[model samples]
Target: MEFSSWPQVPMINQKNYYTEFLKRDDQILALRLQQDERLNARKKAAVDIDRARAQAAQEGLPFLEPDPDLDEDEAMNDDDIDNYGSKTIVINVGSQNMRLGLATDALPKTVPMVIAKKAARSEAEDSEPRPKRVKLDEDAPSEEWFGEDFAREYNAMAQDFRTSRRGNKRRVLPNSRELVIKWNSTTPPERIPEHSDPLRIDWTELPANPAKAPDYIVGSAALRLPEKSKPRYQLYWPLRHGWLNEKEYDNRNMLERDFFLILEESIKNELGLTHKKDWNQYSCVFIVPDLYEKAFVTKVLDELIRDFGFQRVCFIQESLAATFGAGYGAACIIDMGAQKTSISCVEDGMVIEESRVNLKYGGYDVTETFAKMMLFDRLNYADFNLMRRHDFLLAEELKEGFTTMSDENITVQTYDFHLRASGQETRKYTFKIYDEGMLAPLGYFRPTIFDHSKKLIGRHKLIPRSVDLYNGHPNDPLSPAQLAVIAYVNQTIPSAVMPAPAKPARLMPTPMVSTPSKQRLLGLPAHLNGDKDATPLSSPAASPPAEDAGTPHPTGEDANGDEVGDLKGAQPDTEVMDRTVPIMPLEQAILTSIHHGSGADERRRREFMGSIMLIGGASKTPNLGPYLEMRLRAAVPQYPKEILVASPPRELDPAMLVWKGGSVFGKLRMTNDSWIGALEYDRLGARILNYKCLWHW
Candidate 1:
């Protein structure tokens, strides 16, 4: 059967089902055969032993008793058995691949990690050359396999043999003659296997010959393993959700559910340890979006703990994870993902909680807007039903051609309907739709300035009166509704942009008034503005200002006297007002988004500063690191020179940076224990609370 042609059959399930069944049946048959052979051998050995014992008894001499503890001593001499509970397995799961091995030792240094590259062919050479196939022994029987072909044929046949014999049935090939094979060319020079010993030949003819060997092998120069290396103490597990599972479902909750299921399956398959047995064996840390509530995470953890035997589960903030993974020294993470755009700030390894933000607009939203626009444009000539029919194809085309912010013209061929004057039947019409004024969705990230118009005088409190100016103007570029949408979208954009002071004027007097006191109490700079002086607000009070002033108060107000209505209360000291800003609950949601989004800026920041690591899948986006670096440079202009972003090696796992760092933390030889194991917590009970107090003391 042509399985590929059958769309109804899910490829993954079909492959797994057949493969697993065949493997099981093969194991059963092999086991049965082995058991029968072993039983016969045991019986023969028993007979020989009994005969020897009888001979001793008949000789009228008491048979000397063998050492009673011989079996115990033999068992002791065998390999030492380890407790299953103590064993640790490191499972590195990725979106496309999985790796599982023991955690006792670091990955083998000698193992080849080569990335295969396509051999480049010059355009001139490709155009000029045409190799003709040479006929060898044209008279030779075409059906018969040659001795030279035997090695190639046998290897292919052997693979087929193994595959075909996977089940209970087995078949043998008809031919059984050993043959030698060597590479041959019509030219004078010949090619042969380089090894001194010839590979054993087999009789069966293979279905296909292998490809020709390459002229050169490309790879890195081999290096020796380090002598005094630390043990492989970290275990990384990644899980991928196939697109097919949630392709039809647009519901976010349903998609998350599906993702969780796939993650569980991945963990089970890659770890070789079931959640039921091993979840409690080690600490499980989760880095997920804020949309997944703490209650939900707690519930999931509890279920895994109670039913699956998971003991300790830790929830790591996704943005923090991305920061750890990306190693973005001191920068913000701009994560553009399927559902949202997120921005997060990282300082060292910690995430700046207040600076994290999320924008609702994302790739999915852009796709949706594009679809609606296409529908609206087509409505001028075609029926809605017809448009819906072609919507999927249209979406696919847009997705393929769409660039972030390209200005290229896109034309799509679509069908339109027309009626003839003497119409007896409908006529099929073809039309080419030119997408006019279609800008790339990239503008969605920028600050939107729109004229607010169309207001029923004071109808809405939030709508300003000036918005009415653009009411009747058809060409007005700004749409208040769109602007509102943009604001809502901005809510979801991670808050990499710190809230600016309500009034910069208010802050001007702040430095002047506070400088003298800061100089006296905190030893701040005497000169309010000096080249060597750092921003007094950012520093701890004690740092002396680089410049010196003639008098503490330039305004001539007594140092002890209150200067009313002058520098005293002119600005309301709004810099202090930053503390009064209420925390947005939705801020958590944005933080979650940035955790999963990725860009180039985040990557560079991570690489350069080993202290800050980027974590989370979002931090893995292309160009995320660079974008973040640009934004950070713009946002925090004060520390332009001092600010440094880390640059990690390109080959490292950017998403797993935090997890790897966490694993490393677990192995640190610190005097103060950071982690509280489940057993200790359970045994101590309420006394665990006292542990925190003791630590502070």
Candidate 2:
């Protein structure tokens, strides 16, 4: 049943089955070409018009405007905005950048998703190293544990291993376990602490701590402030790791406000929009993450319509929108954003929910890793620290400029690059890299290279996904099936008599916190601990209504599902926190998503793999397209089928591909039904999205 290798029979390779595959492949190619041509219609028209104009100028003919019985009243206007789809605005906001423009426009204007606010002066922060090294534990092996005797035995026993499996290289073969097992050195640990000391910052002299500081500068302008003037302004990145940054604004209300203001200021500065009243004329098409939080979705809807006065709006999952833009019916969507990398198998126009996987490190992590690796190799930046805003920006520029994924053995060559900081003199650096360029990018596969992975290995800041919702959040309404199950438990089970249990750690809204009732599972010898020690999930009648009927909830939720006023010994969830934090590596995640999305249908899996369309900001890395295909093939040597990694046509930029698809979708007749009007939203509240979304949530 499993395909460890291709069909061995000669007939299978040469007969009617092989012939049919070739025919299908040809058809797929033809269809792809046709789709590309169709998407490039606007570009073709512009090119042809320019040619005609040049011809007319050479012939000394006046440029004539063709009058084709057009009516001025039919033209798109602000007053009749709803009547025309061309006026629809597409917005794709990421932690690093924001894309905004009309649906009909060829390209969306891109801007940094940053804000600068006036704040009172604060003391400058300085970097200091950790305490001196402590002695090894009593049971731990001495530093010279792996001595000559162990190496002799290991080397002698390894002679019988298969030649193909015996990879004796480390710099070239990254997966090889060969180590310099000697008297003094040591065998590398399986897992290591990911982060080093990131406490150093040159710009800590700036004013902050005031999340509500008056923000005026927006986008690229925020990063343009002079080094001297920066002391009076606080520059904040409102979004982080595909969500509202709680570091700057922990309060949910302030988080939304920061997001809204960032977008508002960006639109005003980029689109030249003057006031909030103007938003009513423009419908919004927001491209959200495929694995989005339900509460976050609702809050965004409220802000876009209730506050901004947008006439109507619709949401599109990034993976689905990517399919539309890429002109593919199915693909294992791998979006490598700045702060995170997400993988999902999108079939037709829908994303397979169970297969969605998000790795919390991406382009930003790579940039940081590249900097650290370079610093170790004598990268010429004086006291270079990522915490220093300029150094971080400079490193980002260098990462994209120097990093490459080509397999052709690169010669060690010295090169020079210029770092032109804002309001500062351009500094030049000369350096030579061996394999560090490729090694830094390899962190995508060997994730420990990204220092954030080990540090993020728990439920500290873990947010609940859509599937984890409604399991027990008081705000998340339960269905009749769940209520029936709970009622059965209460009626038959003796253990159900205790107070409510604490909510699951995965369901916790924010970072780990204690509930109103200090309910913990490890109650003092159960008999000694009375009912007052209960944590979550108490009774059937206690559960909220199945349908969220727009009922108001208290400011702070009762995580323990008990009375709000009972503030007894409410300890946090005691049911062992999950320490298994590292996400499945990129290759494994993609393969798993494909298998799940396709189920047992191998043909469907083949189709998805054949068209591994790459997108997102980080996806544009040089030679990344081909390198991903090679890696995928290497991961599955048993499958001989060609794994063709498709990319955007010359007419499309990967950065704007999703936005372009949103524009294309917004103009479709079927999309009209998906749009949620202001009145409909007010009546149904956030629950309206459950019905409006095109695919099963």
Off by over 4 Å in 2: 1-83, 120-214, 421-424, 453-582
Write one digit per residue (lDDT tens) for candidate 2, span 1-697: 7576776654464434424553552344333443454458546656776898899999999987533343333333544444566658789988888888777777899988877666553111222211101222323332222233323323332232223223522224432222211211221112212232132223333345545434566777666554446445656776777766755554666666767888887777777777878889878888888766676777788989988889888998888888888787778778888887767788867787645656566888778766655544444442455544566577787888888776354335556665544444445555666555766776676554455422222222433333334333233322221122222223332232233336654444222332233442211111112344443233312234334323332121221233221122221222221222224346655664565455446688778888777788888878888877776777665555757776776657887888888887876642244677776677668766765777654
**lDDT comparing candidate 1 with the true structure:** 0.32
> What overall lDDT goes with each candidate model?
0.32, 0.57
* Per-residue C-alpha lDDT of model 1 across residues 361-392, encoded as one tens digit per residue: 34433444344333323323222121121232
TM values, all candidates? 0.34, 0.63
lDDT at 189 for candidate 1? 21
Lowest-scoring 10 consecutive residues by lDDT in candidate 2?
Answer: 124-133
**Best of the candidates, lDDT:** 2
Please estimate how well model 2 matches the true structure, expressed as its whole-model Cα lDDT.
0.57
Error of 1 at 328 (Å): 4.5
Which stretches of model 1 miss by more than 4 angstroms? Answer: 1-263, 269-275, 278-282, 288-293, 373-401, 406-440, 443-677, 680-697
